[model samples]
Target chain A: MTIKNFLYVNRKAPYGTIYALESLEVVLIGAAFDQDVSLAFLDDGVFQLTKGQNTDGIGVKNFSPTFRALGDYDVTKLYVEAESLAERGLTADDLQEVMYEDEDDDWAEKPSIKIISRAEMADVMAGADVVLSF
Target chain B: MKFGVVVSEGPYTHQAVDSAYLFVKAALDAGHEVPRVFFYHDGVNVSTRLSIPPQDERNIQQNWTALAKGHGIDLVVCIAAAQRRGLLDENEATRQGKDANNIAEGFRISGLGQLIEMGIQTDRLVTFGD
Candidate 1:
């Protein structure tokens, strides 16, 4: 197997820098190339998938809508770090939409995308053919 | 495997540089070739020779210099990003009439063309940013 896997890790707040935005763009491009793409939100990166992002208050354009488009790009695996979400006081409900939705917020959902610990993040990188972080 | 590293964080404040070094070492240990490392945005700080990290610590600027010398890696600093961040090489420093210089020894100052080239040549492009 060629293992054309791409793991895009996002690690910044939503608005301040172009990191999050550019990362999403790259994911779309990867999917267009027919690669197996997975997105991991870690650290402050979880903010990229956070719900109720109000960009109107900041006078900048909103980017939340673009995230919903990931599914359209065939980006199926969306992993969020449980520790990061706990630190930010965010539950799966606080997120808009994800690869596998967990209504009960248990350890498993649908295909079980793994709401992993920080230690497992390296595994995500280890399996990936390419790891692009923002 | 060939690799391209995207560094977008400043040297002293973030873990991007440290991660880049670790990734490069691991790749080499795994028997991979690093074709090019591209510094963009705030990453251009790696080229600033003025960095003085206290004698007690491993100066990051010097660390990168040593890494490049040891591995013969291609270290590229983005010119636009460098100019915006006040980093100057010998030519730019003279043209701008700066009194002193601080960009590290082993890295080459370049443009986004290097990034595109690396993208085309490398098997994987790993990025570290904040």
Candidate 2:
């Protein structure tokens, strides 16, 4: 089987609808297929990684923790748009530290999320074999 | 190249279905092979046989039906999404004891695995949505 580059574009916030959750479900399942997977957070999607998310009042499952587990699934390349963060008044410090262990460097822990410009992100998107947006 | 199209919005309310239809039409016109068009989320609404649009406007369901009939394109609507949105096929309607089945012709209800398979099988998996 060919190892295709699967780029999942997440542009929706968590909880307004089922897109974010369902998109996450697809990613989790896609990870099992062992594809070259990477996730991009753009527009309102940047909000999905914000820290201190509380779903108690909204009655929805807090899926923010699931983002952390994505690293374990080998989905460690998370690209967050710099413009999107600026528009939302968010910084890297405001987001969760999703990290993965580096297999090449004696298991050294490294951050999975990368803050990137929209142009650079576009290049990454254009490089993908299959782009799945949500 | 084989194209896998995913429509994630409903008919009329959003332009996703219309755009997807046009994209598929253009792909076929260009002599590209579209193996499957997967409908998920509110997109399953496109496969509902009960959608009766105004006479003047273009009928979204019929557009897809014609595409399927004309090109032999496989229209696969996500079963979970279809069930949640009340877009049941004959088998599902019978199993659930519903008197009516609203799944339009040329569309079959399948699992999300079909979408994943499309990702693996096709050269490009383009998605249209809100």
Candidate 3:
């Protein structure tokens, strides 16, 4: 099987609809296929990574933790758009620390999320073989 | 280049169908090959044969039907999404004990596996949604 570059674009907030959760579902499944998967958080999608997300009042399952586990599935290339974060008045400190074990170095865990410029995000999108946007 | 198009919104209510149609048409015009167009979420509604828009307005279902007919493209509606939205095919309607089937011509109800297959098989998988 060819290892295609799959870019899963998240442009929606976490709870209003099922898109965020479903998109995460696809990512988990896609990872099992041994594809090269990367995730981009932009626009309202930046909210998905906000720390201390509580769904107790919303009645929906809190799926924010799932994003943290994406690293185990080899989906560690998370790109959070800087412009989106700035527009939302957020910084890297406001988001959860998503990390993956680095295979090259005796399994030392490394930060998986990368705060990238919107222009850099565009280049990332252009380089993808397949882009699944939600 | 092989293109896999995914439409995830219902017709009229959103511009996803229109954008997808135009994108597919442009891709075809540009000599690109579109092997499949997968409809998911509310997009399953796009395959319903029961929709009757005003005569003056463009028929979204017919537009997809004609595109599929003209290019021999595979129009697949996600089975789970279709079932939730009541867009059943003959087999599905029979299996579910439904009274009728209303899947439009050129559109077949299938599984989410098809969507994954498209991503793996095609050169590109472009999604249009709300």
Candidate 4:
């Protein structure tokens, strides 16, 4: 049988080579095939979702804007690692105006985008039919 | 099976290498074939033979070397990315007027075509980057 559920883990920054962007594209492709899909961001991967990313200084277009379109691809289960954000001195407020607050709130109930600790992440990975980390 | 690997992070001081190694081992153990392991941007460093890690730490280059030697896996380094980073084969090293080549054996220096090929042949493509 075709893999029913796929988990895509993105661990890169938003700019530079298209690793983050391209991984999201692959997730969308999987979703289009009628597969259950989710995404987890870790390490610098959390930076990809941060708000107010200024890429113009580097002579590159700001790619963070595209992240807002993920919902259209049916990729709603966005996750961020709590430790990575803290290490980078970034709170949910520092990110683009998404539901990042729920991400940092460990006590929040049924938050749209939850920030999970590394230990809590194992179950998320264990449940996927295929797990792709990028 | 379909496989897609997106390696975006550089090879130095990063978990991208370790993560990719674990995933590849798991995939192979699960009896899945990795059709494409795309090394983009800084990931092209895995193809270099000039890496010299601290003696105490595990050499990332050697891990890749062992993977290739044991499995006969196809390791393709992005040509454009490698050129940008000055990673070249023995022939390209000479042609580019460089003193030496650092691309290790068992790794082919190729282009994005290899990625597209993997997408076509495998059931899934797992990426390791950043």
Candidate 5:
């Protein structure tokens, strides 16, 4: 199959709905195809990457740790909408630091989450071959 | 052109699957090919054969099963999501030590990989969900 750019558009908060974790499932599974996979965190989705997500009290499996494992799947490039975070009274510091190993740059560790403007996010959406919205 | 369909909501709770069924039917009527429909999240609930809607109400599972049978479309329910939601196939029920399976006709329990494959294979990938 020809390589395609697949962007997963996340627009929901974690735990309240099943969209967040299920979207993550698709991303991890899609990584096996060797396609260009990237994720966008907008609306309440920015909360998904926040640090210290404990599901112990909720009695649900905490899938937040899987975000860090994306690097191993070669699925990096998490784009967070700056406006969304601002509206939620959050900053980039509030998000968990997701890092990936730079295979081309002597295997150095690099941050995957990019805090971008809404316009840049529009451009990213326009550039993708497939936009899988959640 | 070929279209790929993803239904991410269960029947009745949301109009997603209903709209998806109509969209697929419309696409087929317009002479387009819909090779597969991938059921994810709560959408896997649509494959349960045990659901019995009122006579006045439309049988959603039957509609999809009949449509798929007539069109040779592969109706796939995600195995992981199905297992989580208690909509298992015979093989899955046996493997997981469940009492019984509830998968309806024309639907098979598969993986998320099938969804990705559909995206790669089809000219257009349309998802119907909240």
Candidate 6:
């Protein structure tokens, strides 16, 4: 099959609901195929990338650590909407530093989360061949 | 155009399955191809044969089963999600050492690759969720 752009739009928070974790499972599984896969963190989805998510008290599995493993899966484009972060009173500092090894750039480590404007996020959405929301 | 659908919510708790079923029906009536419908999260619960609702209300699982049988569409419930929520087919039940299985007719347990494949192969991918 031809490689298609699979944009996974995450709009929910990490723990309070199951959408975030469910979406992550799809992303990890989708990485097995030969396709252009990317993730968009908007709304409360940005919370999925925040650091030190301890879920022991809530009795839920903390799957936030799995985001770091995305880089190993070669699914690295993580677009975080700037407006979403601002609206939630979160800055880039509030996000976890997920890094990927740039294969073409001498295998250098680079940040996966690209904080972009709302306009750019819209363009990213429009340019996708298939947009999967969760 | 070919359409791919995802039902991510359960039957009565949310209207996602209903809306997706209706959308698929409308698409088929208009002579469009709907090859697959992937069920994830609580949506996987839609594949249980044991779900008995009020006699007056609509039978959600049966509707999907019949529609899939007529159209030869794939009704895939994610294995990971199914396992977590205790929704199992006979084979899965056997493999997992369970006594019984509740997978409805015309539905199968599969992986998320099917969902990704649907996105790649179909002209459009539609999601019905909360």
Determine the TM-score of chain B of model 2: 0.97
Writing each residue's lDDT as its tens digit, candidate 3 over B48-86 gives 899999999999999999999999999999887788778
Per-residue lDDT over B17-125 for candidate 4, one digit per residue giving the tens place of the 0 to 100 score? 7798778878778977665567766788877878888899777778877886777677888776788788999878888899988888778788655654554456666
lDDT head-to-head 1 vs 6, winner? 6
List the candidate 4 regions with Cα displacement exceeding 4 Å: A1-3, A99-112, B1-130
User: Model 4: how far is A61 from its true place, Å?
Assistant: 2.3
Against the true structure, whose DockQ is highest? 6
User: What local distance difference test score does each model get?
Assistant: 0.76, 0.92, 0.91, 0.71, 0.94, 0.94
2 versus 3: better TM-score goes to:
2
TM-score winner, 4 or 6: 6
Ordering by lDDT? 5, 6, 2, 3, 1, 4
For model 1, what is the alpha-carbon lDDT of residue A31? 63
Tens-digit lDDT track of model 3 for A46-96: 999999999999899999999889888988899999999999999999999
* Model 1 stretches with alpha carbons more than 4 Å out: A1-3, A98-114, A117-122, B10-33, B44-130
Interface RMSD of 5: 0.6
Q: All candidates' TM-scores?
A: 0.58, 0.90, 0.85, 0.53, 0.98, 0.98
Query: Candidate 1, residue A43: CA error in Å?
Result: 1.7
lDDT by residue for model 1 (B1-130), tens: 7888888888878998889988998998999998678887778887877777889976877877887888888899877667767888888889989976667899888766566456556787877875
lDDT of 5 by residue, B10-125 (tens): 99899999999999999999999999999998999999999999999999999999999999999999989998899988888898898998999999999999999999999889
Candidate 5 regions exceeding 4 Å error are none
User: Tens digits of per-residue lDDT for model 6 on A1-134?
Assistant: 69999999999999888999989988988888979998999998988988888999999999888899999999889999999999999999998889999999999999999999999999999999999898
For DockQ, candidate 1 versus 6, the one ahead is 6
> Which fraction of the native contacts appears in each prediction?
0.24, 0.48, 0.43, 0.14, 0.81, 1.00
Q: Tens-digit lDDT track for model 4 on A41-118?
A: 888889888877887679976777766666556566777888988999988877664432233357343333678888
